[model samples]
Target: MSTQTASSIEIEAFEPHPGWARQGRQPRIAIIGAGMSGIAAVVKLRRAGYTDLTVFEKADRVGGTWRENHYPGLSCDVPSYWYSFTFAKNPDWSHRFAYGPEIQAYMERTARDFGVLDVTHFDTPVTELRYEAPTWRLTTGRGDEHVFDVVISATGVLHHPAFPDIPGLDSFEGEAFHSARWNDDLDLAGKRVGIIGTGSTAAQIVGEIGPEVGRMSVFQRTPQWMAPLPQKAYSKAWKRFLRLFPFVQTLLYHFYYWYMTSRVGGAVLGDEKAHARLAEACRRNLAENVHDPELRARLTPDYKAACKRIVVASDFYPAICADNAELVTDAIERIEPGGVRTKDGRLHELDVLVLATGFDPTRFILPTKVTGENGVDLEKRWDDAPRAHRSMSVPGFPNLWMIEGPTGPVGNLSLITISEYQLGYVIQCLDKMKRDGLEAIAAREEAFDAYNAYLREGLKKTIWVTGGCHSWYIDKTGMPNLYPYAPQQFRKEMQRPDFSEYRLIHEV
Candidate 1:
């Protein structure tokens, strides 16, 4: 095992110069959200010879969703082996499916290792970003204004919590909070817990609180297909081997990536038989876990596995079969002063309410407003849906790149793989601009439109579109805006910069 000390770099102060024409001042780059994507961008930029970069994080720390969602049984749904950055591998993962703190610590370690934390402006939320033809102008919540040559909006779509607009939800007098913003102070011991929504977060919360609470009632709009996670502690021998031989670790990562990606094509786009097999796996898992016939029946999903994101839990089903827990599939009517009332006129009294209703994923690049050429509002352009060329650049937005951007696919694969590819593409663009003395490079409208159309068509055959389940992957218009159908196709498109698809202006 390689013994290395933690980073000793001191966090730097933000020093802003005048606009684009200022001499002796470096061309500044503003990165919104100090999450995995943003931090990866900074590291890649620095490696590519760009030094003047600033990362803005609204929260006090850098772990993004990991730092925010501190609810009970909060852990990564994806396997830890596949969830991390390809560049930085951790040989010391405690569990196959790591908990929240372990994941957050890994992110912190990555930032510190790359010395990106020093240049980050924590607790500074960007209010507005306007393109001033030659440069970009940014205003933060602190009323500070800064100008930059480029901006990268890595503030991921999943951070913002979305509560259902049910009547009397606001009138609930009891302690209520979203799953993302879990109130840790409210003790669940001997309390009647009413959990809404049956997504990943809901499953985790139910498993955790069922053992502790006096009575746990879970309101399920739709059931979720769950797979058993063979989550176990890493043996000392495995850790030693990984630390000693890094190449072996890399090979393992490649193997895992391909294996995971291969499943997507079959699970998402293959025949109904394949989907049925996955559903059977879920059924078998639930039956084996929960001995109670009634509880197993309630936990069984009617839809296919890939229709919604298949959750992985070792104890979630077993927890539901516990004496204190009960599953309610009826629709919620309203929240009375004391408890939640269902459509069947049943009022289930509860001491605390947990809303695991997921996020407002359609609101991409939110909170941080972006203005393109001629005061073009990015939000307005994406009013119908978020679109981008190769999920990186949009038309009229010059020198602006987004990591984990819209129409990018999400699955068991590592986000670091996509982030690395994007960073490479962005850096190559910047390098070309520097070499040719270019002023700006923006995606052409036709290219951007064609890309979106291609992505939409590709998604039609996938389970997300036809699997009879609604998720954050689809927007308000029932369009898939989050990811592509195939990760390989997306990677191939980002392999080389297509200068023809972009309008480049040279510096005179």
Candidate 2:
């Protein structure tokens, strides 16, 4: 039995079953996590008449990233109306941007309402997932094995913590933890705190805890685009109006999609006038919040706006300018028994060190071994540079689909929106398999390569590529790992499943 290349394999068409006229066989489906992607899959699957589905979540709780990262003042950067699922809406969001707890509760409630809670296998993580010819066999962390006809890789990026490899980091005398794994039992009241990495996470953490700490020393590598967040509690009258007029809420949701993609994304791509205009707005916002020239300069980003993720914080600038706060721009040399030592030959002493260091955004799947045809490992196949056709399927891997594949979340649009679009596309592919009695489906390598090449070509003019900042959106080669297109473009791309570029493998 010799193995075959994806292009060389031949898939024969089978005649329909006599009973097929009555009903089609529902494929056994397994979703990896219960996060937003997984939950979206479960909800949509059930709606599409897919009952044989199970969601395996490693954690005991339902909220994926939100449940993990509970640092000070954690919240969704996007508005709550736009950030929610298509099937559910929270009209009573206390603020425009929902906090971590509220987002987690929303996820929990969505799971409950969608009946995904009962189908979810809690505390069960897939230790190994491999494709066996026509089906996928998954092994749980508990050492149990199960087979499924289709597997959706929905365990998205941003879960794994990327800790800096500073010298003597392990020997830190004080309590140190990543913002993703925030320390709750240990109080930082009146304690000198040192926060590292001034990215999106760092901005929120600093704003939330700066007023309470005795002293805050923020170590920065590069400045990010900081914009003012008009975060405020909803007025009672407004909330009541939103609840009464549900269409108004729906309209608001669509408006955000347009605003973030067309308005914000257009500014970054070939719109020089708009780019300068938005940049001026951010600079003015920074000036109004931070009075000190030095502090304001330090807060200002040299990169173009929307290069890295723009930090939306109302208090982060003011927090850094506070008398008890000190922003350290020098490179970190090492960690000592007392605190961090910088290249400036100064030891920034601290009682607690908060690593606001963001996750390895490129690494979408961690700790999961995915093997495809001929025992080709997915990680080895990617070779540090991951690629997928339309951020969904790969060539060698059949009957497997990635929810938010490489460069999947490049656009500033809501990730939930992206997940559903991909879900809908994959479901159509699976339905074709069920209707046609096909055993395997793999994307053509030529198609995959073509899509990525087009993405790279388009990225050359975008802020993430041309802008001076090095963000997680790009790979080591400086080529973007994201799609580098507007949300509307992506939606248009996934609006239909093009089978011309795929190898539909029918069972012999």
Top-scoring candidate (lDDT): 2
Local distance difference test values of all predictions, in order:
0.78, 0.82
Q: Which stretches of candidate 2 lie over 4 Å from their true place?
A: 1-23
279 Cα displacement, candidate 2 (Å)? 0.7
The superposed Cα distance between candidate 2 and the true structure at residue 422, in angstroms, equals 0.9
Clashes of 1: 4
Residue-level lDDT of model 1, residues 420-481, one tens digit each, is 88888998888777776667788998988777777777778888877777776677776576
lDDT of 2 by residue, 183-214 (tens): 78988889999999988899999999999999
Q: What would the TM-score be for candidate 2 when compared with the true structure?
A: 0.94
Worst 10 residues of 2 by lDDT: 1-10
